[model samples]
Target: MPKLWNETIDAHREQVREAIVNVTSTLVFEQGLRAVTMSQIAEHAGIGRATLYKYFPDVETILRTWHARQIDSHISELTQVRAGAGSPGERLDAVLASYAHIAHQTGSHDRELVKFLHPDERIVNAQNQLREIVRQLIEEGATAGELRDDVDPAELANYCLHALSGAAELTTAEAIARLVALTAAGLRPPQS
Candidate 1:
């Protein structure tokens, strides 16, 4: 096959795979995970069962892929927020706020669905990525005198993640913001 044809085929395959993932996610979200079947997903995705099998062996595989995609998207969004033009303190605030918002939204998902998705290694890797991002920001802030130097950056990073994880239980944007503010406050240097 010509190079252009090969690239086109690859792009088409990716689009089909993404479509299947999206359809599976919608079915799982709207119909509940247990109620969603592979046949239903294949039909809803407009692909034959055989084609769906080529992409995913079972409903669980499809759901896992969808969850992995969501994790990637969330990480990418936070990376952008961290990279946005701002002072280190301001960037840190933005990143924390973005992360808290995601946690708050995810908290509303069905408990069963959350449980199903939470055990994957991808979640652990994503968390480690999130920690690294926050750690780098903390180091920047500490060096800039915006955050306390008394605490190690890695320790502060862990503290920030654990503190903000509580945002999952928060009910309102105001509450989440308050939580983020309190977490940020803990990072601030003490006055003489």
Candidate 2:
């Protein structure tokens, strides 16, 4: 095949895969994980069952692929949040709040979905990346005397990640903000 022809084929395949991932996500959200099926996904995606099968062997594979995409998007969002205008302390605050909101939004997802998607190595690596983002901010703040020097940055990073996770259980933005505030407070240096 010509180069242009090959590029076109690759692009078309990506579009089809994107459609499959999106349609399956909507179906899973509407019908629950176990209720969704390959046939339903194919119909919703406007693809044939054979095409769907060619792209994904099973529903779990589709869901895992969808989750990987979500994780990648989230990491990009957090990186942007960290890079947003602010002093080190201010940037840290924004990153922590952004993460809390993300946790709150995703927390509403099906518990079974969370359980299934979280054990993958991709999730473990994404989590480590998240912690590294937090750790860098904490170190920056500490260097500027904005955060506590009494604790290790790695420890504070762990503390912030675990602490803000409670936002998932919170039902209100006000409540999540309060939780973020409390978590951020723990990072501040003690007053004389």
Best by TM-score: 2
lDDT of 2 by residue, 83-159 (tens): 98988889999999999999998899988888988999998998999999999999999999999989999999999
In model 1, pairs of residues that clash are none
State the local distance difference test value for candidate 2: 0.94
Which segments of model 1 are wrong by more than 4 Å? none
Name the best candidate (by lDDT): 2
**How displaced is residue 4 in candidate 2, in Å?**
1.9
Q: What CA root-mean-square deviation does each model show from the true structure?
A: 1.5, 0.9
Candidate 2 wrongly placed segments (more than 4 Å): none
TM-score of predicted structure 2: 0.97
